[model samples]
Target: MNLTQQISEDMKTAMRAADTKRRDAIRLLQAAIKQREVDERIQLDDAAVVGVIEKMLKQRRDSIVQFEAAHRHDLADAEKYEVSVLQAYMPQALSDAEIEEAVSEAISIAGAKGQQDMGRVMAQLKSSLSGRADMGKVSSLVKTKLIG
Candidate 1:
């Protein structure tokens, strides 16, 4: 089943099981998806749905970091829960080694030799690695490869 259909089915299960947290998270996801569809005036494919999920996960990660830094462990934990739920829909994340390999390949493909080429390298990396790796880690790996 497509992501949207799968999510809809899961939402029904969550409701039947009385899983409030899961149900709420699923509703939030549906809202985000619906909002995007309405704004864009187009139906989102599975890839686009994945993009929305990734965007939500990224936002949660940022919120978790900020909350933790501000000594709001409770808020941070809540955001982490949302992140976990959202992650269930994401593609399997790349390992560090895999990210490094992908970065190496991207650098070579972009002919990125130094800091000046960082932008081009990063652009390619974002396109290739979106939803597959943590971009912050990828950026550091690219810098190391380019500078070393």
Candidate 2:
């Protein structure tokens, strides 16, 4: 099944099992996906769905940090639980070694020479690394590789 169909199935499962937390998390995700589709006036494929998931994950991580800093463990824990639920749909994360190798290959493929070529290199990497690797970390690696 496609990601959307899979999400729908999971949502049904969550509801049937009386998993309010999971169900609520999935509802939020579905809302985000639907909002994006409405705003863009286009149907999102699996890749776009993954993009939405990543965006939500980033938001939750930020909230977790802020909540913890404010000594709000309860809120932070809730955000963490949401993160766990959202992560179930993400593609398998790339290992550090694999990410490094992919970055290196992307750099070479883009013929990136120095810092100025970072954008080209990143654009190349984004397509291959999206959902599987953290772009921020990949960017830093690209900078280090290009500078050194």
Candidate 3:
């Protein structure tokens, strides 16, 4: 099944299981997907849905960090749960080694030699690696590879 269909089925299961937190999380995901579809005037494929989920997860991670910095342990913990739920919809994360390999490949493909070519390399990597790896880390690796 597509991500959207799978999510709808999971939502039903969450409701039947009386898992309110999971159900709410799924609803939140659906709302984001629907909002994007409405705004963009296009139906999102699974990849697009995954993009939305990844964006939500990133926001939750940032929130968790900010909450913890403010000593709001309870809020941070809640955000952590939301993050976990959101993660279930994404592709498996690429390991550091895999990310490095992909970065090297991107560098080669873009013929990137230095910081000046960083944008081109990153654009290539972003299209190819978006949900599979953290772009921040990938960018760092690309920089070191190009410079060293």
Candidate 4:
């Protein structure tokens, strides 16, 4: 089944199991997916679905940080729970070693000589690394490799 179908099935499972948190988290995800589809007028493939999940994860992480800074542990915990639920549908995360290797390869392929070519290297890395790696981490690694 596609990612969308899998999410639907999980939502049903969550409802049947009386998992309100899980169900709500998934409903939020589904709503986001549907919104994007409606906005773009295109069906999102698995890769696109993964992109949505990644976006939600980023948002939740930011919210958690802000909530903690304001001493709102309860709100932070809720965001953390959503993050965990969203992460379940993501592709397996790349190891540091693998990410390093991919970054190196992208640099070579893009003919990136220094910081000036950062965009080229990132463009090369983005497609292959998007769902499997954190782009923020990959970008920092690229910058370090280029500068050093």
Which candidate achieves the best lDDT against the true structure?
2
Stretches of candidate 3 off by over 4 Å are none
Candidate that scores best on TM-score: 2
TM-score, candidate number 1: 0.90
User: Residue 5 of model 1: what lDDT?
Assistant: 97
Q: Over 4 Å off in model 1, which ranges? A: 69-71
lDDT of 1 by residue, 1-148 (tens): 8999999999999999999989999999999999999999999998899899988988998899999999999999888888888899888888988898888888899888798999999999897788888788899888988889
Worst 10 residues of 3 by lDDT: 134-143
Tens-digit lDDT string for candidate 3 (23-68): 9989999999999999999999998998999889889999999999
- Residue 61 accuracy (lDDT) in model 2: 97
- Please state every model's RMSD to the true fold in angstroms: 1.6, 0.5, 1.0, 0.7
Predictions in order: lDDT: 0.91, 0.97, 0.91, 0.96
User: Residue 5 error for model 1, in Å?
Assistant: 1.4
Report the CA-based lDDT of candidate 3 relative to the real structure: 0.91
TM-score of 4: 0.98
Runs in model 2 deviating more than 4 A are none
- Model 4: how far is 143 from its true place, Å? 0.6
| Reference-based TM-score of each model | 0.90, 0.99, 0.95, 0.98
Looking at candidate 4, what is the lDDT of residue 33? 97
Write one digit per residue (lDDT tens) for candidate 4, span 1-148.
Answer: 9999999999999999999999999999999999999999999999999999999999999999999999999999999999999999999999999999999999998888999999999999999999899899999999999999
> For model 4, how many clashes?
0
**Once superposed on the true structure, which residue ranges of model 4 sit more than 4 Å away at CA?**
none
